[model samples]
Target: MKRISLFLLVIASLFSTKTVFSQLILGPDTLCIGNELQLSTTVTNASTYYWGFCSAYLKNLPAGSSIAAGTGLAGPSSIAMAKDGNHYFVYVVNATAPRNVIRYEFGTSLSNVPLATDLGNFAGSIPVNPKGFELVNTGGNWYGFLTGGATSITSDIIRFDFGNSLSNTPTIVDLGGLVLNPQDLYVFKEANNWYALTNNGFSGNLIRLEFGNSLTNTTPNVVDLGNPGSLSDPSGMWPVFDGTDWHLFLVNRGTDRLTRLDFGTSLLNPAVDNDLGNPSGLLNQPRDISVIRDCGSYYGYITNENSNTMTLLTFNGAVTALPIASDLGNFAGFNGPRYLTRFLRDKDNVFAYTTNNADNSISRLEYNTCSNAAPPISTLQTPPPVTYATPGLYNVYFASDEGLPTMQVDCKLIRVLPHPIIEVNNDTLICQGDTILLVANGPGLFSNLWDPVYNTIAPYDTTSIFIYPKEDYRYNVHLEFTQGGGCAYDTSVFVRVSRITADAGEDRL
Candidate 1:
């Protein structure tokens, strides 16, 4: 009995230790898609652990089915997945203390199966400390950015070319002089050029590196957008070329405002377009900007780091002053959203992937059926249907046929009219007995009339009318339309029969 009790006590202690070790501590997680999504979670607490990919499509994943399983005696700082035919190859940072080492795991099926072969230390001397990393695909190969370390003056961009087995030697691109204590690095390709942006605040010293046949010069060209009398530090800058001109969406650190930088005639010396000012009150600490191109225009999605919101910018020649922040999924639940990328899933569907740094999770949002909505119908309504007396800007009372409501409403059997626009440009002046051509500019209404009440027919087919007024009179040209709702009316003012000297008197003078 005494021996049995001692054995039970030892078993109890072991169980307690194992339970404590099983808790998962996740550091920043990232998700990417190809054949299947590669979900990476960084573990910090335990050295030996098991990890597998359970489909996010599965609300409650079963215990056995996962892409790959792995065990390591060292904590993993990062994990990456590679496509091997229909299967995926899983790699992890296995150890760190004695020397940085990486281990490999492979599986035929997405079930939680152990690694078939133990490929030891794929890369030598894994950097001691890593800040942030982004996985990139180049020429059918995968690479990673390992940033931040003690005694490491710079960040290293490491390339992993997976052939029969993962490459043992990774080409390291040093960013020592470029970034100061870099926190994160992202690689984006635009116009056959690949550019990288770092979190290091180096004022006008943002590194602009180009990659092609070989990694070009590390001495990146720097362009400083003169601070617009604001002490706001630059957060992130996204450069986009709109076929004709290059524009930069700059996130300001001090005021949480997004400033547009027009690269003028040169790539450098960007001028601020004040007309396309920051939409009054929206983002707080905007971090990154991603653009989605449409037919001829571009829409930008700016990630607000502090508020955890995204502001959408509709790019015209100059960006519209008013921007709409589509209330995507709430950020309160998932905070510290650092960056966002938009992908068009199908013909009429779009998805936005946001990287939440604090929650160690990525959120995917889908917007569907955007094109099936009703087209905007504009209607103009005027009181008394007379004409203006003077040529000046006037506020015409108007409302869309849809409604005055802020949100979009669909399929209501209501005949709503759009607000009327001022008719200042429609004003006309003509001399006595002198013919003047009057043209109808507004939509829908065609034929014109000379009488003030639109009762008398004028000699015009809604295109242009020859008017000859004999005396000083205020004439109103009535626009006539014959559609479903017959004879819609729009009036324009004309100052006819103006005082003028005769041609014979002018020749005598």
Candidate 2:
């Protein structure tokens, strides 16, 4: 009886060890919307490995039904998944060796085609293995970063700028004091300036760096958010510049929340405050963040590390918990998804990339069919009418909703002309028969006509007119011009004439 009990205990111990060794962990997922998602993974000691997507909101996924697969290494390491055109790129570290290998797959499924590239040697001279890597583009140049390793001699950040040659060697940019063992790196531009954010040593303190036109000149700025330590630590950090401001969001590992930092007002003196107050609560180790501009709103996604769930946050500062962590209705399984990225196919289409650390696979989420709703449109106003008698140029104005999520429309200006008026020197005045001169003046008109009984004189387009007042008689003058949408109208003025006595011939009126 004693021997049987000892055998049962031994079998239980072996089973527990196998279970622990077979577990998988993933992180730093890359997204190229509507096209593909690249996920990285690290598995414990195991002879063989398999990967697939499971319904994030479902219970069970069948075995051998995964998006992709790769052989595992001995310990913890970092990998990168990205898309070049239609093909997906998977960069992995060899478990048994220091060499890193690149594999190519189609869509989200594993491929049997023998298409792989070796990146030659590590980009940096440091002997420590890399913890996070990214493919970056700056000022029309293709560059990348291999960050965080064991060696103090290795650069914290290394840049790869492949100029003109597919096989060209990458140039390394050493960020001396800007970063330290950066676990994750994100780069974005605001107001024509390039900026980067990196997670430093699981301390929950993020380092900010700015790049000059030349890649070598990098300046470092640090923003310390209180640390939560290793158990619930910060992982992926994403930064976005919305023309006016820079928004930085990170995964809060301790409280399972998505914390937002607004740097829109003062880029130089950024005041780090929480944009969303700890909304995503009780999440199992959130990893990556992806944001999309939709209908004048911003949508955010947070990928989970242990549970099959994702947290969604709206730009209105509202957070909604989503259970679509797995493939929609597809029986593939998601074990430990660590990172997420978003892509925009067009103005109307969008997609997301999720990396499952446990499954060593990737999942693609797409929003293809959009509703045909009218985009936000508005009319601009020119200068409003005022009761001014004088004629001069006035400043016109226009206003509407400026910040909508669509193509901008051109503005048009419309002008409105006011009517003209004319006045005579006097209503009644006596003048001698000796050819008294009469004068008329007012706002200028396009055309003016003066009629004397049966004939018309001074038919000119001018502001003033002069005529001889004959014996006590009345005369009429007319002015005409186009007004309001090319319509023509005429205004008339009346003048009274008087006969003067012979003694009044020398009198002035």
Candidate 3:
């Protein structure tokens, strides 16, 4: 009995060793909105989906990041933020009918109260297994490609073009029989040529596809990159241009590993490298992955299905040969997260979302403290327009009195223009043992000062100074102002000495 119990424990440990990750597939031309991070997630086999809004200010606290508010959807699989900041499109796959495309408009706030509208299906034909898809622009028009279903019967790669809004039913062009059982698709452009990439789950291959001038082309030149790094069950794929060549990264569900495939210049030839090999037993069936460029660095976020965790990966360049991966542990109410998407524009207030199939819920995750904590309102008028008195070239930062996360903090480089121009009177001649008054003139002059300190009734307020010199000497004085924190000043003026000679011996007086 003791031996049997030990055997059971060992088997359980092996099964739990693997976790899942996510790939946040976004539509083409989607950009990060202003000041806030918006995330939309889909829950599979569930009746409803979810979306959340978080402040971009919480960029520092990745773990402590929380959703400000969230709203549920009827059902959706893929989501796209429109070129217009106010609208969003989502692909809703229905088993009974052709997939339905829906549009949502954001309200005054990130409230889930989206005004929903239906945009019909792909040529009125519902593919059996619809999975990964992306929005692409071709020949001054918008198009979308969806991959999934069987080999060819239902497994066709369907292309849909939107005339104006997604409201009209799109014209469908099939590209499945050639690629075979494609699970996901991503489209990119190089020079003048347009290319499409997809992963065939059954064959374990990444296929490179090219279109001849038009995205509506039925037959495209296909290049099959057979399993890089001997990848097993390639679930998610993302390619990045590293200012040089395009490098592809994918997660293998069977091996619990992430690998990199490099295609130099052209996709015809390729090389493969292992990014993160299963060590410390962290990666357990990673399902999806997404990459965003921030501050000259590439950040990769993955969703773990079995472990209900998210992994963060960082690369030095746009595309990295090796990356550092860290596990973000588990979040509250996250179950079997499958898909993820990130706001790409601002890395400071980074935001990403995941779809949990097990619990039929969406998990929204944000990084940084600005997004996690509310913008603190100071009791005192913060960012008090304190004049930058002395200025050359300076980067100024404004903060609240408490030094907490607040909207007042604006760290920016500012060139404070030189103070109002000022001029002092020219050199003057004064006899020995005589007093000379110095004067200065300038615009916006509130006060003046005499340098080489001389006795004056009102040194700070008076514009003139009286200097008594016993011998032949030069007197210098400068004018100062109270504004600009007393830093604004005028050039110094000098008083020349005049000599007087006395001749008593010559006259016998």
Candidate 4:
């Protein structure tokens, strides 16, 4: 009897240990198209890491199956998908001396028994301790900026000219002091020039560098977007253009919060769009942010380093001033997730990938909250095959797994061309010697443009005019519809002028 009890106790202890160690970690995956989904994860601990591919869409990830991309990876840091969508170049960094990169053909493994053409040593001649890097193509030339240096002097941004083929042999030009202790780098286009933006972790300020044509031998403008809070160690910056202006979203690791800056006329002076203050919920060590605009709504994904989780938020361009973040629950196997990026286009669905530093794995997630959820409560009945009938505005709420409250997403509907019906006082007969008031009305019309200029209030105002004529004439008024719809509608009325005769006395007549 005692032996039986001892065995049961041992089994219970093992179960408890497994539960404590298990975690929810998410990772980023490279995009591979064609029905099946493929992903590559870099496990830093093991020299031989597996690159896995899932066989189902993101929503079916919980039940999907994945296979190894290959073995023999030295813990890669970042991946840059080729413009062709057929090749992927990965930055592999291990505890070794120099950081390295390998190019993998689509649907091929890095550890194919007989490897073909190894693109070796990603960190060629660029000092140690690599942070983050971005590659961009401009005017037929591929350029890359790598952020790395010594611990205290890690503010150097290395520029690599990969030529036409993006060869591993790069012409290096070190642009030092672009940002004080830069952590991550992002590249974007404005007007005719290209700009590089970085987060200075040490100085707690967001910096921007502009370069045209060539990053080498050219002096770039450096602008400092001062951090509002005290310990705002800014990490990641993402920007989106909303017709009129650019909205820049930033993640501050020191402050543990998300803030936005708006650039009206210039990137120099930025106004705070939304300041959630310090100690925002579940933002512990927020590292990277990415935005996916789907179905007239912007979905923002953020990775938190300390919490080992990812958060989702919604930003409606027309409605809200700032984005409302919702905890979309945690990825089951992710640990210390770092980078978040949107994967290949899947119609209206949002599929995202993240990279986990703690476990060195990649995760795929599907967000159907805004796309799949039922349209908010509406009174109007939708026509056949249509979900919502009303064409105004709607709202959606997302609940995050973390302590963050439910976030709302706003949606709007605008009809392209609405057939407007015009109504005017029918064929009126008036004496030309006297002035008369004529009014035109059209429901659901935006503006009106009338022909034959008469006494009017405004040229584009609702048609209300007064006219007088000396002879019998036809009065025509051309009706113009608002909302930039189709053609114009016209109607005419007749006015007859009469001669008034006065008879004094009939005797001499």
Candidate 5:
């Protein structure tokens, strides 16, 4: 009987080893929209190797470096970026005097200067300061929500309807009052219900607002989530869903420690605080944090107020108490870094920014995501590139080691971007020796190249150019957006020159 049991255990061990060793690797998980994926796998020479993209697995944390984001920002506290079908808008709260919200609009890509527009103060003017802010886009419309902090008395949360543009006078609604000062607020949607969660710094209670199915719901179901975990001065928090359950990791400014809470599946339910004692890098008052999940791991960047530094904490899963902390050190401090935000433009392109409240400047961290990349391709020959007309998230999948029961499989999500349409003049008849302007105009910025250089005007490379043509010319223009991921388009124009004939009917006499 002992020999039989040992044989079974040995066989089970071998199978486990096979499952781990044959596990396929298809990575650089995050991709810029419209970029062609050069996919291939390591298990080569198999009868067949198949692959695609869908839900994926990630292993390690990516590395990043910090710098200050440009100038012209004043007392900016919280920042959030939302993508409309055609463009991206960044909203920042000017938490100081003459308090108002600043919008930075970028088109197609984040390569150029963004247009900054100040959308007046909260309704009834600015009384109390603006707290945690978030922007969410549902259907085709954009919505901006700002939390009001308590000064001498309780304040109400406000919502703004941006329609399609954040520039117009927003339709604002005061969402009622709370007893304590509100801290960091987060807004998200699940199923048909839209929800916003905000915790008060003074009351130590987490508040939730349910907007139901409508983005414009004025009367939200407000609930005071009395602090469940002895959470003192609750401030910065980040949530993650690991296939089955939803977990929240937040910092308690009052206790100078870290706490984890299990919210079962939905964040709507009350979260049971799971305390994770103090780690070394938490520093003095950990104010705000942002979390990113890929390959089954969570990477969170936290801002410590008193020490004026940033710390990088990682976890194996959402509910784990063992958070590995690494103090990224201070970024030329004394400039109290208050809140932090991150934008993963794509794999190989990641950036995080911290709003320095003291000096009124923003510090940016650029991460290197290109290390240990092994993208798997099923078909030995890479498939011809695909062009997605509209922009959104898409599923990709791949399979390998065909004809075997233990074939390897992997999947991930891919984003598609909109096409950059080149606007120019149509076929036209021009008088001989006359000059005409050729223009390719659009929003954002682009690189334009005009072919048939002969007879073309000076300033050959630009969005709009003048042409002094002596002959009928067919000009083809190739355009590429300053937006990365190889987003490009081409179009052409023909110019007909009408010349007056000064010759006899027959050959010259």
Candidate 6:
């Protein structure tokens, strides 16, 4: 059972990178979480106003040019980078031993370092001990989602269907256990089904796997969203939907800090949830985390693995606009950097790659621009605090430091409005007192504003509650189990309901 991601209460490590972009600075690309935006940029010799950060690049071998040495890469844990057209693929996974699954190919530039191809052993054919990997490319095929097991993490989800060449050779079918040593897995797609979100790290908890639209051999359905707060090793990938709630951004590594889990999009009694902690004592054990939008903003890259270094989070919308430490002795790459992936090397450049279990090498980070020296921070005409707590997309530029400045840099990709998922469900925390919660799944309805019967022991309504006044009342429940411990039945399907606004509305249970 020794698998806190295979021994890492510390000593994990990072690097394997790259970097982009511009924009005028008007404001309002989109915002809905904690909404606010204001700024002006029309040029004027540009004295100083730099609120932009692609965070420079090029560590170019030098600690004696250190930590960038691995021909076959050894313990590298998690990583997934894709792009079939101009070729650029990376996939790592090796929690030690012959637990293979490595591949690296480059062309058209990611600074080209490539060298390591061995995608075999399919994580020991479910002997469970891989870590994480996800490539996916839907319908037309091309898939791969790996997350080593602790036993049936919901039908042992370790699928792979390379129908269109991800180098083919996949056929593993794991989706069994629900969570205990899980580790990582982030495949996503809601409504049309096909889900996955794993991160147990020995039960710091957080699991979900539905796989309806295929994970190859299909056979899943487990939603054990346990451990709602104060998670120390908690780890389960990422999620963001801010029109009203579906948050989930995580990374704890026994608590280096960084978290979120609103649960507002409903997963049938996914029960009362909300973590929201984000502390950054500088992060040291952070195993994996990634996001990119470069230059205009929306950046987050963490992999401290006991401080091998790599932590840059500048996302002012879903809040986080401070922590930026990428000098890894002088630009980046210290080694042991766990997992990372970021693309977009054109239209403004941005290339971040990582997977370094202490020297399995690979950390090319090149986010372009921003190196006036030391801090390089500048911003005055007031335009920096635009809030957001949950929602995505943000690319805010203000740059204009006048060293050779022109004021032609542009950026504004803000789109943040994801609360309209059928009005909202606040993550089914419908509790009352002494414990009670209901959201009977899809086409919902368990009551309107309360007291429509949700247990005090009875209201397990013997089926039949279909109202339709102002049009659209639902009762589509696919249910959640409970009976020997008290009422909470299921099996009802009627579609078209609307009236969700209680995330445990005044909880007392």
Q: Which predicted model would earn the best TM-score?
A: 5
Task: Write the candidate numbers in order of decreasing lDDT.
Answer: 5, 6, 3, 4, 2, 1
Worst 10 residues of 5 by lDDT: 1-10
Q: Over the stretch 1-509, how does candidate 4's per-residue lDDT look in tens digits?
A: 00000111211211110112111112211111111111111212222211111111222222111113244334444433332222333333321344554444433221122222334564465545455566665555666666765355654677768775454556777777566677666675556566766767777676678776444544788887666444376666666555455666778887788777777645545555566543237677887776544334456667787877667666655413456566655654556666544232221233344555555444555433232213322221111111322222212211111111121121122221233466776655444346665667677544555565543334435566665556666656665443232224567666565555433333210
Model 4 stretches astray by more than 4 angstroms: 1-69, 85-97, 107-118, 122-127, 150-152, 166-171, 216-221, 228-231, 265-273, 278-280, 316-320, 346-351, 365-509
Evaluate model 4: give its lDDT.
0.47
Q: How close to the true structure is residue 494 of candidate 1, measured as C-alpha lDDT?
A: 57
lDDT (Cα, tens digit) per residue for candidate 3, span 1-509: 00000011111110011101122211111111111111222212322221111223221336422232233332334443322222333333333345565554433222234455555664665466556666553443556677667565656777777755444456777665666767656676556667777877877787888886666778889888776656777777666655556676778888898877777765556666555675346778887777655323467767778887877786755455467677778853566666554342121233345555554344556543222212321222321122333333222222221111111222222233455566666766656555566667676566665655643334634666556555545444444443333334446655565567533233110
Displacement of residue 459 (Cα, Å) in model 2 is 53
| Total colliding residue pairs, candidate 2 | 14
- Residue 72, model 4: lDDT of 34
TM-score of each: 0.42, 0.47, 0.57, 0.53, 0.60, 0.27
- Candidate 6, residue 504: lDDT: 43
lDDT of 2 by residue, 248-341 (tens): 5667665666666666544445436563444535356666666544322346566666665666554553222222222223323445655554
Clashing pairs in 1: 66-110, 398-419, 398-420, 399-418, 399-419, 401-416
TM-score of 2: 0.47
lDDT for every model?
0.39, 0.41, 0.50, 0.47, 0.59, 0.51
* lDDT (tens digit, per residue) of candidate 5 on 186-296: 676778787777787786788887889885787878788788866788777666656567776778888878777788878877788877766774657887777665333
lDDT of 1 by residue, 218-281 (tens): 5454333334433245555555544455555666655666666565543434355432335656
Candidate no. 1 TM-score: 0.42
State which candidate, 3 or 5, has the greater lDDT.
Answer: 5
What clash count does candidate 5 reach?
A: 19
lDDT of 6 at 220: 76
Candidate 4: clashing residue pairs, number: 17
